[model samples]
Target chain A: MSASVPTTRLQATADAFLTRFAGIKASLPGDKSLRERAAATVRSKGLPGPREEAWRYTQLRPLTDVTFETPLHADVDAQALLGRLPEIAAPHLVFVDGRFRADLSTASSMVRTGAPSFGSGARPDFDPMVALNTMLAEDGVAISVPHDVDGGTIVLASLATGQNGRAIAFHPRHSVNLADGAKLTLIEIGLGDGVYFHNPVVTVSVAHGASLTHLRLQTESEQAFVLSTVYADVASDGTYDSFQLATGGRLARAEIHATLSGPNAIAHLNAAQLLAGSQHADFTTIVSHDAPNCASRQTVKTVLTGKSRGVFQGKIEVARAAQKTDGYQMNQALLLSPDAEMDSKPQLEIYADDVKCSHGATVGELDAEQLFYLRSRGVPEAEARAMLVRAFLDEALEAITHEAGRAAMETAIAHWWDRQA
Target chain B: MLEIKGLEASIGDKQILRGIDLVVPSGEVHAVMGPNGAGKSTLGYVLSGRAGYEATAGLATFNGADLLDIEPEERAALGLFLAFQYPVELPGVGNANFLRTALNALRRARGEAEMDAPGFLKLARAEMKRLSMPDDMLKRNVNVGFSGGEKKRNEVLQMAILRPKLAILDETDSGLDIDALRIVADGVNALRGPDFSALVITHYQRLLEYIVPDRVHVLVSGRIIRSGGPELALELEANGYAGMVADAA
Candidate 1:
């Protein structure tokens, strides 16, 4: 299970998987050059290794140990998967088993006009998953909000189905562009049942003076494996607020990389992870302040029960020239059972002279006195514990601005707690 | 309504209450005053079923039922409330929400319907107004950033909302100004009825002026030494527990 084995295995798997991409890659109706270049760059990079800072907390051994071919264009009924989540009303883009299903997706009339365009820039040397996704990923959903557009939200649902014994792997690529002065809320839900692996890469670009609030809900099955990456670039005077609620998946790791590339850019990253049984969840984030007068805040809260484990590692870096930068990070975890464990590391790397950077981490159990107080008030023992757990997670949930999105996340959390109970 | 006979309790093998006997009947306010380290708070905690106090030998009964075998919430459901001396500050839990939850929990336990949001709000507002507490206190986190008098007022607010049959005020009058003390006293006075009983644990007799007790007992070294009327509190306040301890010895 060494790191090099996964990298080498993934490289060979990618080479074999590229044969099935010939048809999908040739059918590029809009931009062939960008697709070809992206594919070439990905073939060269392969998959990411442990040396990469973004992939440090997560090990891809579980995903790469078994060679997986690009899943066929399987027949999937997304309506069956989406039981009651329609309450999150928005333009729905459904991707089943790594391929976009236009028939299962919502009506085109719900699609907003003036969609922002996406460009595939020069690929980097590292980040093999980004390269692999760029080279082999099928047609993904592109959502854009033009400059000054309002009153619209796009929901992207990626669902995977495992019908056979062979492990199914899906790489979903999404690019979101927010025009200057535009405001949009995006809700991305990664949900699947059965035993499968899903690797999703989402790129968000916020134009000058625009604001984008992204909510990622990861509630996959206990037998499923998920590795999600969110890459965001904030422009001058723009705001980016991202939140993640992870309560499912046997082993789920979410990486959020936000770069404040313009002056006066603001970024808020918050995540809440609730896991029980043998579930494992890792929330790793990196916030980079590249320009002056930028501000970033990150807070991660986790609650672990049974034999579950929670990991949170947050890093805030302020560049040398990023003067007057304000960055703060905090990660707190609560372990409910004796066998439960949590690991948290909050780090700050500040090279700017006039920057205010501070980070803190705490890992412990529920306060005994608080539990006693709640129990003394006639709340049942189990109900009191749940209330305390909910209160512990409320800090991160409060950071979500969208009322409907927050309510949806809370309901998901409650459902998970009910299952545990 | 409550009886403790031959009660002996300890913490980590060190007996705090060697042997205690007391009785608080219905429609009476009994004040237990003593010097520091006299186990005043321990008595209140033990009576209300707090943990960490091992009852080596005790026989406590409340309304003809054995109280020692019940859990804290069960005791609370049976109409027992202990106003903490140092009320814990629960961050992120709103004061209004906590009170409503506690009240509704008790109600449901007693086979009563839960209070609606509007009804709960109206009752909370009236109680807050009666206590002279600011309206904003209801919206803030429970006891977080609250001053001493504010915490005391919060306890009184809970008393008003829950309306337990037996209220144990463990040093409730310690950190309060005269005006705040009068408000708390008025809250307790309003709840006074033929079926209600209270055990007030305090040091000074100053609070007795507002909420006079029918009987005052002097607890020295975990045992009640003397019992008399309200005049006993005044006498102890003037002479202090030193003379009383010497006389008992």
Candidate 2:
């Protein structure tokens, strides 16, 4: 029996959004033509509800309950908001409430960063959240890595401010273009009070032979909501390495879609989602190999405690032309509480006959043997569990090749553990 | 000093240790020799407070503290150590960090000042050299990809570093080669003094050759069948466990 697309409040939200935002779509980043196309897409697609298979495990009903206001306080100070944010010795940029803070940014001449062109473009049919973010995104950060340049750590920190009485939302658009043979590492960090929602959309274009390392640390406020989307298109022989560390927000999701469009291209999507309290976090990824001789790998680990819930939905699609494609994905979840839960769905859609695509998912609690082993060695029960959880998640964090970025992410993980303790 | 009186333990519904009575005074090393299914490992687990191995009908004490009543870490804090028969492989946890953390935990429990990195490194390096472990082992994850002999040697290295009062070694000699057995035995011997004692559990008497025990006890059907001097180990080694099993039956 086919399930019907039930009428939901999200659909009602779509109607309200179109009625309120149809004419003002030009205020969004991108060209006027692109904005027009995006406006049409939003009007046609709308926000998805639980009726959608992709969003079955996630619900946006809370969004429907409260109206999200665009907090564009242009004069929001960056220095004051930088409390507890460690200073990384590298080129960086900061954004407060999705608006860029030039006074707090440091970039080299080899990199040119700005907002997108006044153009419009359409999103893929997979994600419905992109439509909303695209419809309302502001001062998107754009980076241009010159050809053959080995760019150092380019830190991009986004702070969402919810000091206002009303519920605020920040949709920050990000665009990064890596020229041929260029190499760069990008770190995106999200931080703020949990009273807001931070919805970020990122587009990455890796040209032929280019390599980009993208690391995201989403440690937003535990009371906040974060729904992030990333789209990356890789050319021939290009490498796209991405790692996500999500340990914050009341409800958070890191959605990534990587399309291998050229031969010999590679994409690695790895993440560690650590949640406590009543937090809910999801890592959804779709790796599509449209070109022959491409390779993709994904490894995600989650640890949830209390009444928290963790979800993973990973899909690897191999098209007919993608012969000799090698795709591998693994998702492992560790539930720390009897009330805690984990839902995992790993799918492999292989149309080509000569492709090697495999995926596996596992959900479990901390290993009893390992816990006993540590405890017997004089480690307290709490410390023993913490050590084991960190070890389990460290496997996914090791995917990041950039040294400094990996350390920064580790520090963030330590902070989360400290709070849990 | 360690003492067990009318010690009975069970895993699930089946009783493993029917009734065990043994005693080892301070500074004495005692060896418990037995065949398969004689509950040698269960005795160690019961004393160390491992979950599920319940001491249902017995009184065991270490330094007059109820061994079965406290948590495993508390047992460790009271100067007890168990060199596992199978050392766990903990990937992503550095061996050095684990050792340091354990040492600091023990120190905190003792109300002694914690050892800093330099002091710990000095002690750890000397102990590792005594056990013939590579210096690079500090960089690798704890026991991950280690050979059987290496794991056993690592266990002994831990015992050497932790400086516990009483150590229970469960089949610590099962997989070690002759050279490794010698080095590991020397590591234990180096810790021998008036304040340190050991309960060595093994099937074969071969390990007794390396680390000679002051007292030897034959365990069969969960009860101590015979207790004697060092010659008892040689007797079991020569006659085998068949006679002991039949007699116990």
Candidate 3:
């Protein structure tokens, strides 16, 4: 019945992607069967359209207009690009155009590159974006920590440099595995220049009693588009805490799926999206509690100015056997301009009788009383607006316990505020 | 010095202040005592450049600057302050940050250097101690989760930090106890000198006992009907506003 509606444009884009894969599949460094299986799925299903439940707020029509090509071997100023990164005194792995550049990165023991590490945690068969990434992934980093070891911190920076007015496309596949009782802090930074398409997939597995802290900052070019998918699994007493700040890209989307498969596991999926002008950003998350006594929390905030639009879709599912489950989700948005827009959806599917689950959403502009209060105390209009915006994002920002990561996010927020003013 | 000549203002279609003529000279504090809905708060709002309180016909000047022709921040920079009866609550904005931002903004307008963090913290702590406010007040969000008296004290704390020349206390003593009244009065008095002046607007005469005023004026129906010394407040306090309202009528 659904096939009656025409999805020709989406199908054309999907077919074009499959054609691109067929031309470069042999050159790609990964399992051929994995790529072919993902290609067959794309060949039949096409990219996600507005009809898809999860893609209802986002439309992929913009991708159909531009024909993206492979990145060329253009000269890049590695030092200048490195200067734009946060000043963290730790070893970092730098990837230029989705391929690791040893000369630009500091050597680290836990880091490995040159091939795609498509871990078992991701479901390419379920998510179309993951399938797209699986079909064309080239080079990505794999970071692993042994049992009971503390890996401290590692910064994985992915940069896309598209020169000569050519719109390039790159798919990076990365994974992080923490063994039992292990701990690691992974900071992921995505930045680029010129027009490009960045499609990345990350799969994470946290063993029993382990903890993983993931902080991501995506600030791409104004002419770029980014669609990222992250899948995480946590075992007993394990914790997966992740936060991402999306302030760049013409159109961006960050989709995450976290599963608590063991008792007493914890997951926190939080984000702050700051967009202006005609930009559009979407943040979607799904937390499944498969075991009893597990807890999951989400606090997503969006600040939209100009004619920007922001979307937040969060869902929490508690299985019948997952008794004593505690889940909380909240999405709040502040529209700075009358022309700006926001759409928030919070869902709770609970089959457990003794579970505690709650979800809430709120959309509002800056409080007039708060603004007047600030201005009456001698703060200028622009400065008062910036202050209020920072305050609005403070709730979600406070959940970031990593000092350096928090500082980097704060710097990005200040820069975003500067752009608004 | 602050002067208002034949000031007439309105909110929406309803007129609040009708032809108010007042003067508050330097080195003096004057009390504008009146009952509810007598335009007491309206006068303060008008003089502070608050939005939507339209001054249909009036002229307000502070330190020789046209008060009504500028923004609220400009009025604040020109040494005009309004202590709201209900001080607003600002969540996620620390008291120290708010105070320092306001102070630095006014300082920048006056060609003064910005205050360093330690210096600002020291000054704020000293001012808080003088107001009898707990040290944690500076660390908390501005007026968030504060008691009524504590909010009033925070207002006084802001007044001390900003050090405005002309302050319009709009019923600042509405919800204060005896001790808080004394502390708030002390905060106001500490700023009293030849360079400072205040217009203390209130309904009760008790506040005037602590923050003594040089003169008292009776305002009714958007107009001042009587004027006298500080003893007038005591008279009004003993014999309520009924007599004055009837006499003015």
Best of the candidates, lDDT: 3
DockQ, each predicted model: 0.63, 0.80, 0.79
Per-residue lDDT tens digits for candidate 3, residues A1-421, read: 5653447878888888998998988898878998888988888778998889899888888888788887765546566667889987778989887778888888777878778889988877778999999999987888899999999999999887766578888889999999999999999999888888999999999999999999999988877889999999999999999999999898899999999999999999999999999999999999999999999989999999999999999989999989999999989999989999999888889999999998899999998878888888899888998898999998899999999999999999999998877
Which 10 residues in a row give candidate 1 chain A its minimum summed lDDT?
A113-122
Task: Summarize candidate 1's per-residue lDDT along B1-249 as a digit string, tens digits.
Answer: 989898888988778887888899988999999999888999888877888965678788888888788888888898888888899888868888888888888998899999998999999999999889999999998889999999999998998999988899999999899998998899998888988899999988988999999999999888999999999998898888999999989
What is the per-residue lDDT of model 1 for residues A249-274, given as tens digits with 9 covering 90 to 100? 88898878899999999999999998
Candidate 1 lDDT at B4 equals 89
| Rank list by lDDT | 3, 2, 1
Q: Which regions of candidate 3 fall more than 4 Å away from where they truly are?
A: A1-6, A73-75
Predicted model with the maximum DockQ: 2
**Comparing 1 and 3 by DockQ, which wins?**
3
lDDT by residue (B25-93, candidate 3, tens digit) is 899999999999999999988888788876899898887788888998999998888999999988879
Q: Rank the candidates by TM-score, best first.
A: 3, 2, 1
RMSD of each: 2.9, 2.5, 1.6
- Pairs of residues at least 3 apart in sequence or in different chains that clash in candidate 2: A30-A118, A30-A119, A31-A118, A31-A119, A34-A120, A35-A120, A194-A224
Q: Ten consecutive residues with minimal summed lDDT in candidate 3 chain A?
A: A72-81
Model 3 DockQ class: medium
The full ranking of all candidates by DockQ, starting with the best, is 2, 3, 1
Model 3 TM-score relative to the real fold: 0.98
